[model samples]
Structures are given as C-alpha cells and as structure tokens.
Target: MCHDWGESGDGAVVVLEGEVGWLSCSLFSHPSVYNYTSALSTGLNLFWYRLPAGHDLEQPIGYSQRLSKERERLWLQPATAEDTGQYICMLSNKSSCTKISMRLEVLARDQVVRGCEPAVAVAPSQVIAPLQEGMTLDCPDLQDVVKMADSSPSVTWYHRCQKFPTWGSDREQRGLSLQIHVMLTTYDGSYYCTVHYQRRGRELQYSRSINVTAVYPSSLPKHPSILQPTQDHIFKVEQGCTQVRLECRGHFPYLAGDWDIWWTVDGKKVEELNNSRFFQNNRQVKYDYGDRTVESVLLIQNLQAKDLNREYNCSVRNQRGFDTHRAHLEQEVPLPSVELGCGLGVTLLLMLVLFVVYHVFWLELLLLYRSWFGTDERHTDDKEFDVYISYARNSEEEQFVLTTLRRVLENELGYSVCIFDRDSLPGGTITDETLTFVARSRRLLVVVSPGYASQGSQALLELKAGIDGMARGGHLRVILVQYRPVRRQGWVRELRRARVALALVRWQGDKSRELTSRFWKRLRVELPVRRVSGVEGGGGGGEEGGSEGEVALRRLHSQNSTSSQTGLITNTVKEPQKVISIAAYL
Candidate 1:
C-alpha cells in the first residue's frame, strides 16, 4: 500500500542485508490510484542516483545484474550494508524537474547490530527549527505503515546512529511524536524513530531518520511586523507626477506561504475598491536563516484630488496576528518664487553652500544625527564589545589593526572593541574563548590578508566563529576588511563566502588612509554608531574632530608602504583591475 499521488515526500527505508529490498519513488506514491507505472504512461521520465554523491556528482544509477527496474520500481535483489547512505530518485521531463531523496540504512544480520525493519513511508525525514524553543518531532509518512499492522504506534527514538543524547527530562511517550522542552545545539544531529506493530501474527518495525538542524532563535517564526511604510507615513507628491507608489515590506520566518501582505484603501481592500488605478502587487523574498521578506506595492495611477484625502494601509498578517501601517499622500510644499533682484543670486549661493556642506561634512552630520536620533544597539542587548577584530597575529595586518584600526575605533570613536591579543583573558580554550568573544560582540571586523589563514588555526577559528554566528542570525554581524590583496586559493571557503555576502572594505594604499576617504567612510558606516554626550558642531570643533580621526591614518600611511596589487575579488575569485564596493547587504 502507498500514499496519495498528490503527496510528495522523502523517507528512509531500513532493510536487512541479503534481503530483497524494494525502493520506490515517494515523489508521488499511490497503491492503486497513481504509481510509477502510471507516471511513465503519462510521458514522465524517471532516473535514480545513489546519494552521498560520487565524484562526478548526482550521476544516474548504473546497470547491474543484482539491481533491476521492474515497472519503474527499483529492486535490490540482495541489499548490502555498503548501500547504507542516501538515494535520490528524480522524476523529470523536458520542462520540469522534481527529486526525492531517501536514506537507506541496510542492517547487517551477521553482527549484533541495533536495527529495525522499515516499511513504506511518504514524507521527508528532515526537521529544522529555532534553538532554545520547544519543538515536537513526528514520524512523517508512517500512517500507512501503522494502519496496515494490527497494533498501536509505539515509537522508539535513537540519536546519532543508535546512541541517544542526554534528554534531561521525563521520557514521557506522547503518541507517535516526541517533544523537547528546549532545543539545544547538542541535539543537532540525525535522529531515527522506530515503531513496532503486529502483522500476520508476527512482529514488524517501521523506522526513519530525521536530520535536525537547530539554528539560532533570531529566525524563529513570529507575528508579522512592517519594516517599511511606517505607521501613518506621509509621502509627498508633486503636482506633475502622474502616479504615486506606496510600498510596505515585512519579514517573516518559516512557512511564508501561510502569511500575506496586502493593501487597503479607504477601509476597503484594493480589489474591493473597484478601481483599476488602485491596484496592488505583492512579492515575497526568502532570506537565509529561514527568514522571508514580503512586500506589497500599491500603485495609484493618474492621481486625483480625492486620492490625496483617502487613507491607504499596508497590512501584513500571519497565524499569530497582523500589523497594519497607514500611509497618506500629501502635496509637496513648493518653494516661494523670488523676484529677479538679489534673491536669485542669494538662492544660487545658498544652494552651492548647502551642496558643499553636505558633500564635505556628510559623515560628521550623520554621526551627530545618529547619536541623537538613532536607536542605540547597546540598550537592546547586553553585548560587551561593539567590534571584535579578527586578524593574523605577528603580521602587518595585526599591526594595522592594533595600531591603526583598533586605536581609531576605540580611542577616537567611542566604541568598545575586543582584539584577541590585547583583550583575551588569561587561560581559556581557543575555541571556547574565540567563539564566546564572537558571540558577545556586536560586529566582527575581519582583517583579511594573505597570512591570516596560513599563520595558524586560531585565526581561522576566529574567522569561522564570526561567520557561523552571522549565519545563525546571532548577535554578531560581520564586516570584512581586505587589508591587502590575497591569492584566490589562499582564502578559506567560508571567508570567501563571507566576503561575497557581507560588507567588504579594501585598503587603497595611501589614498584610503585619510579619514575623509571612501574606505573609512564605508567602514564607519558598518560600525556601530558611537553615542555622543553632546553635539560636536561649529566649524572649529568639526575640523578638530576630523583632524583627530586623520592622525592615526596619517601615522599608518607614513609607516607602511604596501607594494600589493589593488584589485577586486570576483566570484571566480580571480584578481581583477576594479575595486569591490562595500555593500552592507545585498
């Protein structure tokens, strides 16, 4: 017996060695409704591949006398313990491609091995959930197997082969499902469940393995909240612009299909308003750590007087609750017309002055504004360091970080920075201390150089810790500083990935040494905003402040003369003539 044809799942099969084991594609399974035979008649092509994939990759299964395909079902005449990894069955054609993978655990009867006899199942044995949260595990696709037997489903759980982890709780059986009060990283491994039943006056078992990944809790599912088109946000519209667009964006975690973001105008949905000009379009983007961003755009074409008075709302909702942000269009205030006397010359001069002010003093103005208005990350969490510098010790990069980057970021900029050599406490394991530092820091500033990775394992450990923390959606964010050009192969895979995904700043010889240079500006933008007790305004104070920031840069510029190639690191990891721009996030 099989499951419904519409159901698509990946399951595990446990078979004893030397026994004739049957493997079926669980992409669409059915006993009599629709099976592989029916799929082939409908012009679908099926291919099988053994998993743990070969050197050539997901290659199709080769011909063998012991293995034969009868009515599109894979038959292992004498299953061996060597064939105990995963297997993928691909159902495809010219237009579409679908694949289902199954773990085949072939038990050897010759040895006293812990084993279970698994029957047919139709669901995937993979589970992913947030760490520290209570999670429940179920034996998916076991319904048919249990129903066929004349007994209740009493499941036994196994972790990492057959060894179970420390439960630290009451081992209460909750039907066929198991529950954990708090998910931990220690439980991050494969788990198998076996359920015994009576069939034909004989005992039988059904087993499956579920690979569990416990990610950081930041990506945990929650009620939808708006990211943009803030509450009662008003967008200014000009008299000549034909249309106005209002966009609302929100981030959701897992099960994005169950959530929605939409627009409503004047207490009615966009479709219910019955206005073609008020139509809306929605899009959902999946991010890493199982987070999704949903955006709803409300386009108002041929804007009219009534449209200005009407209220527009962008609402987002999940199973828990919903969040709505109201938006309104208001007429942009026009500048007062001036007589062609001295007013015109004064206006031009004023505009020039404003441009110079903004172009030259942008960083100062931004820092001042952030100090006053921006939400300080300090209050939100109890992180000790604002920045943690990861670099190769006893090298030019370390000198640059300790003497230049560290000094400026700590002394000039009011930020608590943690550098391993300078700040690490006495006597702690390298892995534990480095990982802890990465966790407690708000940002990791990786000074990438040729010597960093090759110098020792400690540098690589720090780099990996930072990347892992960021990937987990933990408190630490990463910022890559290309101190000097490194050969493509010299870079670690994770570091290369981090460079591609996170913000990257390059040192451009003496040019980037200036505080006013683009390199420092970009690097400063990624750093946590320093809280200023009082505003540092006035021409004198600003100049003094700028000069102070320039002091260490100038000192470093005079000290080290780098004779390295200034080039961009492309996806091919090849050295190119162009420089890589620092992107906060793509």
Candidate 2:
C-alpha cells in the first residue's frame, strides 16, 4: 500500500577490542564481494545506519578517523564495547529499495584462565550432513580470533569434550576444519572448537561449540512417484483454442539432490525440437521435511496436423528409482456434412428470435440477476431504512405511492421502505424526527408530481435535508421519481440540480402498472443492487414468494376488478396528514 522496503539480509560480524575491523556491506557480498563504487556509477545510491542494541530507532553513521566509512566497508579502528550493535547498508534507486543488516559484536581481551567455565554463549550453528555420505565440518567463529590476533589462528576440535581419535575413526583433522568419511546417527552431536592465537605478545584461547545433524538421503518415501497421466491417456484439442500445454508432475528424492523430471516429445527433448512452436517449462516444490517435487509442462503453439499424432512423455528419477508416462494429442471428430447443410436455415431463424427477446427484456433479465447474485447493502453499512418515500400528501401522487409504488417496493421486492404517514410515531418532535429519518435512510425517494409541494406541505424541507445529507454524510443517495409530467421551471432548485445528473422516470398510469413494464424496470435498475428476501406481508418463503411472476399477475388482476378491490383512490378524502409522536419506523 505504501513504500516497499525491499528484501533484507542479515548476519553477524565478530571482532575484538583495540583492533581494526572491516564489515563489508552484505548487499554487495555475494559469494565473495561486489564493487560498491561501480554500483554508484550505475545510478544507485547507498546509505549506512547504526542501530544500537535495545534501541528502536537507527542513527545515521558519520565518517571519521576512528569509525571510517570507506565506500562499502565500515571500518572500526580500536573497537570498543559501545560500537556493538547492528549496522545497516541501504541501497536504492528510482524504481526499488533494499537494505542489508549485520550485527557487529566487539569482544574485550580475556585474561588467561585455564579450564574456565564458558563466560559467553555463542550463537549455535546448524550443519546438515546426509547419511552414509562424506562431508566436511569447519570450526566456526575462527574469524573473530583472526580479527583479534591479526593473524591466522590454530584450531583444536573435540566431540563431547574428548580428544577425537583420527585413526580408524573415519575422521580426519584439517587446519581449522574437520572431515568425515561417512556420516552416521552417532555423528549427530555437538562438536567443540577452540581457537589458539597470539595477541599482543600473549596467547589467548577462544572456545565455541557447533552442532551437526545426520539426515536421510531421501525423506519419508524413498521411491519417486509420477503423479500425472494415468495409463494410455489422450487429449482431444478443442475448436477455438490456439495453444495447448501437456503438464507432467513427479515426486523425486535423492542423496544426489537434483530434480530429475523432464519432458520429451516424440523421442526428442522439447528444447532440442529446434522449432519455435515447441517449448517446455519446469517448476520445483520443496517441503519442510527435506523432500521435493518437480513438474514440467510441454507447450505447443499453433498446433498443426503433424503435431496431433506426436507422443509426449514425462520422466522422473532419483538415485533409488525412475518412472515415465506417455500420452498423445488428438483432434475432435467433425460433424456430418448432411446435418450441417440441413440445420443452416433453422439456426439463422432461431438466432434472430433470440436476439429480439434479449433486446426487449434485458431489464427483466438484469433484475433477476440482481436479486439472485447481488450483495445486500446492509452488510456494508449501519443504516435503518433502505428507501424513504417523500411524496406530497392529500394528492393524486399520494394515492399512487401508497397503492402501487410503496406496496411493490416493500411487500414484493422485500425492501425496508419508510413512509412519512405510516412510520412517524408519537414520542419525538415531528420536525427533528423527520430529518432524522432522512439522515438514517440510505436512499431518499422523492416523488415529483404536478400536485407535489402544495401550499402547506413540508416536501421542500425534506428535499433540502436529503440533499444536505448526501453532501455532508456522503452515504445517502437521492432518487427522483416523477409521478406525472411537470414544467422544468416549476421544480425547486434542489430538484433541478439533481435532475442534471439523474435520468428521470415518468409514470404512465395503467401502462406502467405491470411490474415487468419499462417504467418499473428502469426504476428497479436505479435502486441499489440488493438481495431480495421475505418481508412482512410479503407472503414470504412459500409458493407465493417462489413464483413472483404469478404474484404480480394476481395483483394486476385485482386492480382491474373493482369487485375484488375497493374504490378508495377516487372516493376517500385523504386523512389529515398526521404529525409524528416519535418511534414506530424512523
């Protein structure tokens, strides 16, 4: 998300007091070392920092005669205990950054105490040797003695604190390292090494311990296993795919310790094919238990007729075993020519019909996808209402809202819909609570109509609150729903600004009554992508809910038949718009 500090490498540098010690930047130390001045000439910058022990912050290193920083090496002349800490070398350029850290441990000269107890514990070293194999073990930390004495030191090796007999013991003593003819389980023990060197006209002894471990030639199972291509497999190439890859995986174990899996096509190595179309790649996987697996893929680009019959083989091998698998590529059989000729006319007609249906009912298809696949908005936000209807009261728009729009949104689509007349309760101040409802809702649905914003209504106040909530809180979305056509000049400034960015939907009375009609589909598209679920009075979790198409058809029939529905829309005078008492819905 921010700056990547890049890969870091760490080690330790041990030296003695009153001696000149050099710590080469580990960033440039490959097997030996890299030229730092050459890297600087190539457009890279380097910086050095000192991190004292027990301190969280790093202090930048300054060059001086006592602590000279010459290019990539940090030189400490007459080393002191205070100089013991971590040294970091940072290398960076325009594109990337990296650093290397090394612990600098400065030790003081010790008095000659024979057969003394260990005053300091050295960092334990782990060396792994394969069983029954010849290996070498070096005495560690001799470099510290070399640094202190300014001369190469003599080393003595012991196992379990006893002189290691060399004759007939399968072991030999080198200058500062030891060699074993064969490794056994008994060899897996701590070995001690003592460095004897002359420093300042006096002989000093430095002793440290090293641990060795005996490992199996191959961990767990010894035999290699081939994991792909069951006996006599064939791959049928598809019609449109231009490239194909034949992957072969193998498990290998070896004391020789090399992944022996490879791919050969038609008795020739994939690399030896000499054609640009044939290539192979390999991947190796290692486990914590000291075993590994290798996989190879043979890729064929722009396959030709001659490539179909070629045999592909994957082979795996270890010192213990070897296995190979073979397979072939093939082409699918073609359809009969008679059937293709007879089906051409019918296929064209079917495609034309399908295109027409998709063009006309794409909205219905989108609505279905939303209910089935879209996420619920409540999962991401803390809100009380999903839809808040702010329609003018005592008007034809109110009848449309209560009868059709509110019923469809709440009962059919299972949204948390809030209506001013139905949701306002008797415990809070009406003016403040109504605005609170606006604040709590995620979507503010404004019903614009010829009768909207009547002389005594608070429609304009609610509209202003919705706009302010969207601007300040930034989570609320305001949607304008046109109940009937009105002049552009008649709309409030807030509604005019909103219409500039929104596509307004016009109501067409009975024509837009069907839930699948263009008007309702467009409105549903603008609503939030949400999961539809069972709500109160929704006839939920049963046959009625499962068959939404049938339910919408039933409602349509009820509207048409006056015998089944009451004529309240044309006859009843709207109830005196009730003021809130405070709580049922906001």
Which lDDT values do the candidates have, in the order given? 0.68, 0.70
Model 2, TM vs. native:
0.33
lDDT of 2: 0.70
Q: Candidate 1 lDDT, tens digit per residue, 115-197?
A: 44233232336778677787888875566556455677567877654433356573233677778777777777767777676
Measured against the true structure, the TM-scores of the candidates, in listed sequence, are 0.33, 0.33
Top candidate (lDDT):
2
lDDT of 1: 0.68
